[model samples]
Target chain A: MLQNFIFNYIDCPGIQSKNAGKVSTCAGCPNQSVCSLSSTKLANPEIVLVHKRLSLVKYKIIILSGKGGVGKSTITSLISRTIASENENKNVAILDIDICGPSQPRVLGALGEQVHQSASGWSPVYIEDNLSLMSIGFLLNNSSDAIIWRGPKKNGIIKQFLSEVDWGSLDYLILDTPPGTSDEHMSAATYLKEADITGAIIVTTPQEVALIDVRKEIDFCKKVNIPILGLIENMNIFICPKCKNSAEIFPALTGGAKQMSEDLNVELLGCLPLDPLLARCCDEGKNALIEIPNSPAILILKTIVQSNNFQLYIFLFSVSSLYKFNNINYLKLYQEYF
Target chain B: MLESVKHVFLVLSGKGGVGKSTVSSQVALALKESGFKVGLLDIDLCGPSIPYLLDLEVEDVHQSSEGWVPVFADSEQKLAVMSIGFLLKNRNDSIVWRGPKKTSMIKQFLTDVVWQDIDYLIIDTPPGTSDEHITVMENLRNVKCDGAIVITTPQAVSVDDVLKEITFCRKTGIPIVGIVENMSGFVCPSCSECTNIFSSNGGVSLSEMVNVPFITKVPIDPTIGKLELRGHSILKMYPDSEMSKAFSKIVLEITKSKEA
Candidate 1:
């Protein structure tokens, strides 16, 4: 049945036939067995539990990229912050699944905040009235201690992050994934298999080296059947705050994200310029979009969230319009709603 | 696995995109240029930029009865390179692995790869003193590491991270090979005039404060990125370039330290 679907429906250029050799997409595809190739492990029951836990959340969006230091965590934080600021009463949670480099704590301004475990599960640290956060960084003894567990242990914690976390009826759950498409991406996609992901926002810099890796990241998404929400070209240019003259800090040798997105057939969500104030905000563990309200980066992010076709935006819009729950027992309201 | 290897120099940085991989690949190439058998192992399981920087992306590892054989830099040189990038399903696919899987992969890269008798082994590690660094340090406990060369940009943020990296090496008992202040200044492409972009001498001041050898300052060369994009060695692309000269000086200093 899968082979038939591959031969007839799937238009992947790499997939010549059902019996053809495994291509790049085939390695991560759920239907790899239809092509008679075996590499990654198939999904199991833990995903079902993850779905049950995540079902309370209205939308799940993952921020991904092939290259590191492309401001993925920052984007995720910005998106969550933007969504939350739009409605003071709406509930939003950002899950920092970037295990190795859990910069969300630093980025989200929740550093040194501890994750408290009750009989129910681990409770996320509340950052604002509407925004809450869960991260492995919260479980660490210190910021510097290395998280050295292998696959099984890491999988255990990821499962725990999904199934055990008391997320409690969030309007949106923004997952900040680590750079690359290997374990965390696979695990998150697998666990949330039942719960439909809004899509992945692939971030990249305006550099050929960075864009080259992002292309493969797109391919990974295609293979795994993860819907590509759009591609965000971050740090595209450095706009001088003084003279307002623009400079290309990391110049694109080849046409960067815009050209690559056109080639890959993905939506170019928005391009964010390098703002010094924004960088300082991130360093100081403050909300960049909120701190510098008129910053171009924040404006671009707001436009992406407020996009006409974006379902999450509509969902958030409708929720805020219906309920004026701002500070009036918001946790209780969430409990009552769920 | 690298018992036959004479010296191991681990290239590390506290922060990402500080040109740790660039320094690693060039140092290995520089050593090979000096007629020494060198092997570059990229233990940065998360972001293996070594293979990409070295232009060995398509080369697959050959497994023998003994172990996995690393790809040679060129037929003319004795530089062998191994990175997790080569093992990916695609160039853009993320490794997405956790700590344990990454450590295992690092261990396999160290012990399983057929690294024969070589003069120097340069291991390019991922940024941060996290799981990957801990795993490499624990696994290579038996091997004789010459020291670690921490690469950093001439920025306070980058320099601060390098201090943490220095602390990690000290805590783990790894010798400090010295620090390379990469992108110390911007060298004009047309005029060859130098400009302090992130403010030069941050690394020098850091070295002085930390009490470690300050290796060499590699200026920002625009061609370095263009050359890396084309998968060519910087030294081979622009041998007389200021960046190549800086790397050569650093290599000379490293070798002199090793001998001493």
Candidate 2:
């Protein structure tokens, strides 16, 4: 549909010359090495276009993990749900950059809906009244079909999702990166540099092995200059069916969530207990937040949202208060540190 | 003169428990010994091991008017070293900085640190092409360097997974200077016959296939492990050891290729 829409109105040469030519022309050009514009365009065309449209949106948050089966998608879905639920009018878009394992659509229950392309760009499938969603799963002919793509091919498709899609205005664009800090994560980070990422939220289990790999992910974020928002411990505990009581399935031996946050000085967002109902809802393509109402998991999600909102409020308050005081020294210090 | 500095070599690997830190440390020492004023920056935020490997402690890092001074090797070669380990109060204390904070710190290390009069800045990255590796590539690109060195073992799985890191460097336009096969073969205690326990020659094959130079093979030695456990480097423990000789040879190859 996006391809069809582009073909109908805009000539390929014109749009290509504006964006694509800047990228292709850089090839073998002496200025290619230091060319930020060309590299940014080639890395992520969608993010570049989005920047032009909405200059107000400051940061893009990407949630990533190393090993699969670590509940990264679940954490992504919860974060998006939390952000949209708390902020009434703020527009939030969940872009699933995980082409192979496109679970955001299923987790958020936006499957079977096709992303429509308009004259401006491609529109994301609405998850709720406020939240918009786009995923490779939504565009797939069959949900179970294997993508079987190499790095470059996958990078191109992700670019198309970002550029061709009409995201309009957004306060936050949370990207659900494929497990492992591999090709997709690199491409997303490089392309979305202009978005000035707030930071990444790393999701992991409480096991030692998982923590080991998760540490690497955390270190990776640090190395790349992506501020770490925090760590979310998924399946921190499990509730007993017979007694309806919570028990720590995997003992928090490493104090993983606390230690990681303390060591990294990032926020430990919150932890979610293992719930059968939540898992079933995700499998059945239902919203986990809606299915498990008044649940501990939902409570945790609410708390994280509140904390993030509180942090933002403090940030804005400090800036405005500084203006009122008109203290040049404090202003200079704030500018330097922040 | 500063703008003329090209090729930042960051040594990295995916599989941990491998001697990635040691390889990176030795590379810096060798390069410095070879007359290149190298800045050995340890970007492993969580586990900053370079300081310990080089026998430098937190107290040794002095603050001068220029900036926080790097811990130097005893030799006149003057290998400038910066690490998170040096900044901490205790060597065992954990780094509690979050993602954004860590990124900022790395940027500070690159831009803020007074790394003047250096030809090669060898960045010793943490294992895996995670955020840390990306940060090095991103920040160093701002500095504009020559390439990177990917360190791996002779194991089949290591060779396979390390290629992912190689591909990452290539994607970012960081040239592959070469790959070093660390812990390639084990020497028998009795006969001293080299045994292919993890399958030797895998590194050579992988380098040839990847079309990068097979720098050299470093044999596994118990003495090196003992030295490491004691927080000593091979260059110090056994200056005339085979492993040290191999490292020196690799450094020569790297410098030659860079000049070429």
Best by DockQ: 1
Q: What is the Å distance of residue A92 in model 1 from its true position? A: 1.2
Which is the leading candidate under TM-score?
Answer: 1
- Give residue A167's error in model 1 in angstroms: 3.1
lDDT of 2 by residue, A1-338 (tens): 56554443343333324444345444444444444344433534466674565455544677876544456766777777777877878888888887655667767776678877789877889988878888886776754344545556777787777666777778877788765555677667766655555557788777543565577677666656565556788877765554555544445555757776676565566788866566556655577677777778778767876774435523432332233332122323555877
- What is the per-residue lDDT of model 1 for residues A60-152, given as tens digits with 9 covering 90 to 100? 788898777678877888888888988887799998886665777877777789988898888999988899999998887766555554456
| Candidate 1, B185-215: lDDT as tens digits | 6544444455565556879998998899888
TM-score of each: 0.77, 0.48
TM-score of candidate 2 versus the correct structure, residues matched by position: 0.48
What's model 1's lDDT at B219? 85
Model 1 spans > 4 angstroms off? A1-49, A240-245, A311-338, B44-47, B58-69, B84-108, B111-117, B127-135, B152-172, B179-221, B228-253
- Where does model 1 sit among the CAPRI classes? incorrect
